[model samples]
Target: MHWRVPLSWLAVLCLARLQPSQAELGGAMCHKLGLRGECEVQQDCMCLCFHVTADNSTLVDAAYFGELGYELILFTPLVHFYHSRGILRSTVGPAGSAPFYRFSPHHREVDVQRHYCLGPYSNPSPHMYRREWNFDAWIPPNLHEQYKGQGQAILGDGKPLMIVHNKYNQEWGAAPTNFISISTLIALFSMLKDRYRIVYIRPDPRQNLPGFGADHNHAEDFDDHEHLRKHHPKVLLFQDILQQQRNGTRPDLNYNELQLMLHADSERFVSVLGGNSVIASYFAGVNIIYAVKGSELTGHGLKDREFDLVYPRLGPNGKGTILTVSTTQHLLQAAANEFLQQQGDTEAGRTVLEASHRTHKPHRS
Candidate 1:
């Protein structure tokens, strides 16, 4: 018996042959969308491709894919951190990779999981801030063990350490917001200085990594360093530690590597928004993040909330408690409540900081 092929079936086969491969189709789609690179989707996973600046990127994005059990082929800047991680199948970038800001994948890449910059589409939660995104795979606790105690000799001073991170960048708006002010630092230091060995961290833009290029922050000059040096003599400055390490015979560690080492020793952190807060959330501790405005409060582009949802997952098994505040008053209050009230209460002849619990500051635009 001879089987006859239908004309419709033949037409379908011809159409399938004529259609571009998924990678080529993705490349064409990316070009049409004005993206520099392309995206390729395979069975149950996708190869997210982009060569954008690292500042516009987030390790959270990479982890999101990892949690979803996707194999990643990242071709972005600052690929050193992504190496050896189980999630990334492969990565292509220089250790000294300098990111040019002309191309941003937020608008271009559409096939991958995106929770940010999703406005202009018909999604219910345009920014997707209403829901939580997992960051468990971003920096596992095991990975942190390697860097732990490396900064202990440098930062250990017999007292429990608290890492304080501050960034002065105009990311959200033209004026400087989402930063811990010098006056606030003075108040915070005076409150907890004697009880805890406070380590202040603010990366200098001028200090470039040995192999990796200097991470850009569009920093505005502030005199907090001078203030800390003059007033708080015992408070360890991260820059000073870097300078000391650089002068001494030690391994050439980049800013992120040094941060990982120092932060591993710390269980508590006080940080401003942006990458500073993200990195601080890695350790299993209470990360008090201060942000006056951003996607955390107002959502990425739409409206819901991002901080309370995804911030905790940055730590191991979502163990970290991320206390987010907007005002300096609330920041002071959280510090007093978490650190002073709990730890420094019984310290003999220690000055107590009174942070009012009555006036709760809500997130603002």
Candidate 2:
């Protein structure tokens, strides 16, 4: 019986030895430093990029790259890693001992055909890009809920709203670029939050507005002159008339309930335009009078006609308030700079403008 027990123990020991340990399996899958034998045996291993910053040594985490199924290709002392998936591609190279990888996270592999440049310049204009528009159409429901929580008033009469003129739809809907324009729009909205009540104009279900059109001309014709006279007597006649007529009735009610009512009711009174002439004329009135740039009109490719009238010279710190006064490209550059300055990086504003002029392909006026 004792010999049989010893034989049973020996069999259990043999089975335990045959099965791999958890540490052994994990080690085979992931690279661990100082495990030369295991690393040399594996078909693929992790490469560590180290750097010294402020007298402290730091290691670049290559685990993210490894999980994406990339093999580190060594070229002498320098290493390069690349991955390709359909039309998207990415490459990671030694960036001063801290390896930096360019990745298109949507696809598993890199796209060799499409080369991407850095900065806001390499980005597409909001009016020129197409696929981006589709993506912009979808906003996470949670974000909408959050916006509502913040008292974001939509549709004055409690009607369901459709986005007629959102900065996201204006810039990203037509362009294949990062969210620089949209970011600027957010910053501007932030700045105006205390002074104005901003609302996105929802499309009327009965009214089908075209996705893209020329300019709007008769925007002012839609203003509620009666309402304006009663509440906002100081409101300009032309301004009240124009907002009533624009297709995407996204109007800023500058913290005045009377002005809001005048514009809100005016939206119900006017017929919307879809052509370039209409848009250009509408913008000519708005931009010329108030020095305010509407994202909706601007996204339709209208520069600030008010530039010559409002911003005759540079404002404080060589800053020009009329950034959206020129071509779409120049407007984008200026907007980007303005955004950076708002973020407390004043130097980045000029850098972005210079980079835009040098790198971005100019849009023909």
Residue 36 displacement (Å), model 1: 16
For candidate 1, the per-residue lDDT at 365 reads: 16
Task: List the candidates' TM-scores in order.
Answer: 0.65, 0.20
Clashes of each: 0, 29
What C-alpha lDDT, on a 0 to 100 scale, does residue 353 get in candidate 1?
Answer: 31
Which residue window of length 10 is worst by lDDT in model 1? Answer: 66-75
Off by over 4 Å in 2: 1-322, 346-351, 358-365
| Candidate with maximal lDDT | 1
Per-residue lDDT tens digits of candidate 1, residues 318-340? 45678888788888877877787
- Candidate 2 total steric clashes: 29
Write down the TM-score for model 2: 0.20
